[model samples]
Target: MNKSIVAGMLALALAGCASQQPEQPFTLTVAHINDTHSHFDATDARLELGNQALFTRLGGHPRLQSHAESLRRQAEAADQPLLFVHGGDAWQGTGYFKLNQGAMNADILSRMRLDAMALGNHEFDLDNERLAAFIGGVDFPVLAANLDASRDPHLSGLENLRPYVLYEFDGHDKERLESMDDAGDDPVVAVIGLVLEDMAEISPNLGELIFEREVLAAQRTVRALREQEVKHIVAITHLGLERDQRLAKEVNGIDLIVGGHSHSLLGNFSNLGWDQNEPYAQVFTNQDGRGKTCVVQAGQYAQAMGRVSVTFTPDGRVSQCDGGNTLLSDHAFFRDIRRAEQHRLAGQDAARVAAFIEAQPNIALVEEDPALRAHIDEQYKPALDRAYGEVIGHVPVELKHVRLPGADGQGSRVAPLVAASQLYWANTPAVQAVTGRRADFALVGAGGVRNSLEPGELKEGHVSLELLPFANAMSIVSLTGRQVAGLLLEAINGTLPEGAHTGKFPYSAGLRYEFSETSKGRGYLSRIEHLADGRWQKLDPQAGYQVVMTSYNASGNDGWNTLYTAQQVLTDRLDLAFVDGRLTAFPVARLSKASGGGTQVHYINQPLECNAEGVRCNTDAQAFIDYVRDQRPVLTELTPATVTLNRL
Candidate 1:
């Protein structure tokens, strides 16, 4: 044995060990908001503070900006890398968007210093040209890995509309690392965008664009980034909280998901009178049963912002994750926001409420960002104020809107009213003249009605611009009782599954049904009835009836494909007719040969005049406004519950 040979071999092994040092762990801070929906002004929310029900204003864009900027400053002082992002649905909820459209959204969000945002379904509420204009105006990149805009002339050339983006952080300063030259080695984290795959079914204006499957897109993008040596991956998604969890379970290498669309308030808000018990930063094991992914979502309408701190191992697995939604609120407290002047809290009550908010880790009383607030007040708000100022009617009590029926079988208190309005408007002489038939019933999905009807003066702005903000035209569809029953069953079944989207839950006027989740009977629908001559009777499967709904529903969006198919069949033999100096089209269901080979057509479900008239022809909103105006002291009862859940 040679001593010199042994020593040289030992030195070589030591050198190899020195070169294989363990990679240092990285920690990233993230601030996120989702489903903002153009709610720039503070919205009223009731919280049980100090054992008293108090009304408080929750997060608006200004408050969100102020809190996010503060967080940015804090992270900078601590030398921690921070990324601010939105989970999408930043358009089309309030009067601001209704009046100013996506321009206002781009202006406000661009100032928030966002890193990236997912494309929400509402972003396609208008045409692709409008969406492209919005993307051009925003400073941050809009992402959608599943979206293929190559065929869209308006969106194909936008450089900032990308599938994913990479960010490199310097280890020493914790600042974003950028290359001075064209080539760079690798980035620290990759932010991937994922949206709903069936976006076309839900959003009608997505012209010449395509959406791929969400899970597949996410998997492919994550793999691509991993191959590029980018380990830490965060997916900003608009797939809702339930789908986000599913994505986390199915995808590998994803560390965290910031989500929207479900508008889930994920945190323990039981103390605040909210029954939200879902854990923030919810963790799920990857598809390969290795690594972990954390999910978080801020509630809808800019009511809260989620802040999460994630620590990644050397191999990019999520080691430790922590955070919750921060509900930004104002200092002023009231017993009832509708009557603030009469219900103001004072002295010990006010102090106790303030103390409670201060003690909560997820609640903060923050001042609005002065510049953004001033901009909103001066630039975009005046026109909205002036246009929506007229008082339409008054209500004595608030009508609540719940997307799904409760365990006790109680559904939304507001959506049924909206349905009744459509039925009322359809039966009017002006509307019936064009259709040549009266509407037997009306159906409205829960998602169509955005907000609860507050108890106070009902302004034109609240109904037309906020509650039913989509401005969808009213549509009448003629279908047999069998088809009507099938439509209800399809909608009910779509929402009955676990983690299903409850927005498809149907609320109706002049119609009622009993549904059982466990029943094998006709898609879980046990019984269905329609009101006729103030009497409720079983829906005859063969009887023909005219159903009124939004044009969005008639076109078969949002799990209502049956209606779309039925309308399409009738549309094949359509005819145009002039009634009262107005031109309208109707679906011709039957054609008979008259004398001399002339054909006579039978019309059904006349298409309302929506084009040219603009938002003025939004009969869905107009109907509700007219109903409230005609029926003084608006209806407050939720009785004759449209849906009954039979648990058997």
Candidate 2:
């Protein structure tokens, strides 16, 4: 009797569902920075203005605070939802980190109020205990969906360490966008963290933790978020731009990817003397072929901030995305800051440079936050100044540190010099006597040299605090010529893929090679030679040669697997001590087991006197400083290219 009534009821219900409107499209504005790397003070930057070179100060955490506050106010006034996120790498770059470790980073970042930060590989530069301490101190969550820290003793119980965070915004009030365990019935935005799956291969201090493949972790998390009725998803990733692009293309639910790790300065900065052709916010079709994902990353060292606006459709797909990276610059400009008099830009020249900066959409003039600046000046700057203030040497010209050779066919101008320094240190009588062998060649990774050598008075701070900041122990590994060739091929091939991290690209002293990207087999590399007795000779495959490199590389991190497989590896931990009013390296001896079951003779930690006389011992930095001081106008003459690239 009720069949007709049931059919009518069903028809009415279907009509009601169809008539209901879809959820309203939401537009979100995101402010992001990546790879700040503990650069708390303003850094010198050069820009091309009006066909003339203009030197000015770029970003610092203080400037970042000021700029972020300005962006927050603007978003609030406009009634727009905004989020400030960091794409990881907030540790290990400058003297600030050397002195204060992650403590300073935690303090500054907590004050700036980041929504979330991805766990960068640099975060693992220290042990898990230290990383856990950092996580404990930060106000915001440190995310890594791919990281399984449950096995780690220190990070296992941390509450702030999470896979993802959920935010349910109420209208334009972003302050109400608090991290929630559940979003109830409201439409929610999920921020997921993804890190490199090969984290251990690059960062060696991750203790008892496991990292899942980034793609798998991201896909699984996005699917779970979607299952929970969360539509909008953003992935803050430490996987470099290339991997981020892959993540965007492979995963369907991610609406945006904020990334770091390769320190890519995305956007068009041609006007500023830097050429970056990649658009800041690039949109890609998701694996499902229907969804769209937008990817963005700010440059390193807090120099630039990325602001992106994304319009999400009712279905949580990115319908439109627009944004660019704005370099944070100080108001002051200079013709040449190195010149004491008449170098400061003033009058008409100042006005012209200001006008140029103002006209550019990607440049922002910002002042330092007074409170942060004062804190740094009082609490941190003095210690750094006292430790690294003395003038070490001078650089006649800027020595650029490009990881890979650019279109000009010139690779890292600074890395080879650094390699030369390592070689010199390895051949020193003290080091040679301890190791029982003189190093034949020295290799340094591009990533090891943190910053470029600006043409000016080089300070002790510049070397230890900025340029070569890691203070890695030096290792001399005896390898056959065949193994060295294999090492170069592996390292170079790892970086040949587009957008790959070029840090692994090798730079060497006493060694040179030609690489062909299009060639196959051994043809990819040719003319492999080592400088012997002041002459270049083809590397004999059967000959045993002692190669000097950082302990990080000798352990097979960063694709230097051949070094780990070397027959003989000797390591030295050099501590800086002022012995008889001279900066001297105090060598210690110890032993450790290598990954390839080879014995690693290294030095263990020993307390040394770091008094007023000057106790600053880092083998790499000290060697470079010593070399520069001994050899004036260092890097003035261009040497034969260490790595010659043939893209064809």
Candidate 3:
């Protein structure tokens, strides 16, 4: 009520705002989401805090929309420029993807009103035609500067894709980006798209497309943009954090890098030894050593959004940067779990628990947007509801699967579940119909599996969580016992790209081998055995056998390339053939169905076109669902008879 006090308070607030401003600065706010992976609805997310793992609800499209809207409002109130960008991989994780291959995500993301998105590796999971179609339906620009579309007829026109986009904004809304309160001449900002170079190795869908080296492609694009008088360049990149950092240090002209693909969590920079929790924005000196380039990647699954506030000089050079992740730690549900843990730790004390719960930090969670929630209820819930209840099988015990590093990030111990399932499908009569015999063993790459089945009841929905993210068809391949040994050698000890990990470590079923982490190259193998008549027998190199595996590995993704190319394995290799349960070989059908007609196709390549009628091929998920349904309760445990023994 005191005028003098009110005036002083107003003056102090203005001073605070001005203190954050740099001379000749153009303050811009960026709201970014990445690797959403179809978590269109809220899900329980786990967090590892110091010594305790906590559960919290994270990510629903509505909540993400609400958060972004709030950012837009905040930026508008501050009279600063704001941009909403998605870092891609909006498909694959949820039942929404399994329903119609991510069509709903496209509609939902468009409704969120995103300006642009980088091309993520998982986008290629749908194959070229489907991906092209998905892009055609999206309202925003899909970016990837390094992807050469000449190989695919559908992608040759470069429709729905841009190497880069230039956008101008002001109060006048000349470019229609949005409004700035105080009208002025529109300032142009350039956004370039960069893809990971090893995309082809990761997804068979990209096998035909050529990718440019990230740094070189960026350098060339930055020069071209600079020539056009575009300043303040931001690269929307699918390159994981490491490559993005290298791109920043190796190339010049880029002002900022918004990245995805690694699902990295950036917060604390000092703990470089751990994978997550790096500083939100890493500052790197451009190659010119004149200006700084700031790189940021929001952690995956739409669980968090990265907010970046940048102050740029009038000359279009970055002057200062600040921001961090806004995690949606909903206390509504997870608090109950916390209470249980608390009560267990301290003997049952209702009053104490109540007091403790009340004493907890009142961190508010973002509310889901009503409109988006309504849209999901109307358009998505029906299918999702059915999927959630559809039974797949029963598990005798929990099959734990997490990306926890074993052998110091070499691989995960949980990979065996994926391998065992692959072997199960391979031994099926459908597989026998093709190879004229049942598969003797199976192998799968560690990274291909997204999650492990928990103990108890399994459903079609659970399958989506465990294995659907890949969209990789199941398949069988015939190889001599010698080739199997050679493949194992190549996987563990071969010369992988610098910084590439053995996360694609092989997990074999019906075969056991002992290897030490200390071994290198061919020396990695110590002892190996095969299950013959449920008996462990020494692997005979001369014998022939059928193997089941993900189509991803069969097509030579990760380190599988070494196994077949004679680079790190035995000299001879074999050809792949297409087979079905009907004892028929549809070579042409398989070509069009899986690997897009590649030289080597996997046995379980699914959603295929089998007959002239154009029937949809069975997907790997379907095969798994069917296999599990028949078995009812599959026991999960490691016994002395378990395959793939690691000394580690």
Best by TM-score: 1
- The reply for model 2, stretches above 4 Å from the true place, is 1-22, 175-186, 339-341, 519-523, 567-617, 632-638
Alpha-carbon TM-score of each model against the true structure: 0.90, 0.90, 0.79
Task: Please give the distance, in angstroms, between residue 409's alpha carbon in candidate 3 and its true position after superposition.
Answer: 8.2
Model 1 spans > 4 angstroms off: 1-22, 171-187, 519-523, 571-615
Put down candidate 3 lDDT per residue, 1-648, tens digits, no spaces: 999999999999876644432336576678898889888887655443332444556777888999888878877776677888888788787778878685787899999988888888779877677788878888888888887777776677765687777677562232532222232345767777898787756666665677878888888888887776565688888877878888889898888899887788677522212254677887899878897999998887777788887778867788888887766545443333333455232334433333443443312367788999999999888877776767666666445554423434333434665566666765667755554657788776766666656445678777754465554555565677887888877775543333344446677778888765453323466787888896889888898776777655765677676444521222212222234333343221222223332234433323344332533333455556665676534645445434333433
Can you write out model 1's per-residue Cα lDDT over 1-648, one digit (the tens) per residue?
Answer: 699999999999876644332367778889999999999999888888767788889989999999999998888788788899999999988999989899999999999989999999899888789999999999988999998888878999798899987776653233333321222433367788988997866876665787899999999999887776567889999998889999999999899999999888899888788877689999999989997999999888998999999988766689999999989999888887674677888888778887888999888999999999999999988898897977877778878888888767767889988988888878878777767878899999888889887778889889889999887767776788998888888988888766677777788999988887784322467889999999999999999988888867766678886776675435432232334545354565643322311223345565434344331445677788878787644567557788786643
lDDT (0-100) at residue 456 of candidate 2? 75
Following a full C-alpha superposition, what root-mean-square deviation does model 3 have from the true structure? Answer: 9.1
Global local distance difference test of model 2 = 0.80
Over 1-648, each residue of candidate 2 has an lDDT whose tens digit, in order, gives: 599999999999876643332378888888999999998888888888768888888999999999999998898888778889999999999889988988999999999999999999899876778899999999998999998888779999799999998776665664324444444445567899998898766876666788898888889998888776677898999999989999999988899999998788898888878886688889999888999899999988999999999998776778899998989999888777584557887888788888888899989899999999999999888998887877866778788888988756878778888898888877877666556678899888888888777887888888887888886656666678998899998898887777877888898999999887774322378679999999999999999888888766766778776665552334343433345545444443544443422234344554443323444435677777777776643455347777798775
Query: Of models 1 and 2, which has the larger TM-score?
Result: 1
Q: How many clashes (backbone atoms < 3 Å, residues ≥3 apart in a chain or on different chains) does model 1 have?
A: 0
Q: Give candidates' CA RMSD values in order.
A: 5.9, 4.3, 9.1
Worst 10 residues of 1 by lDDT: 592-601
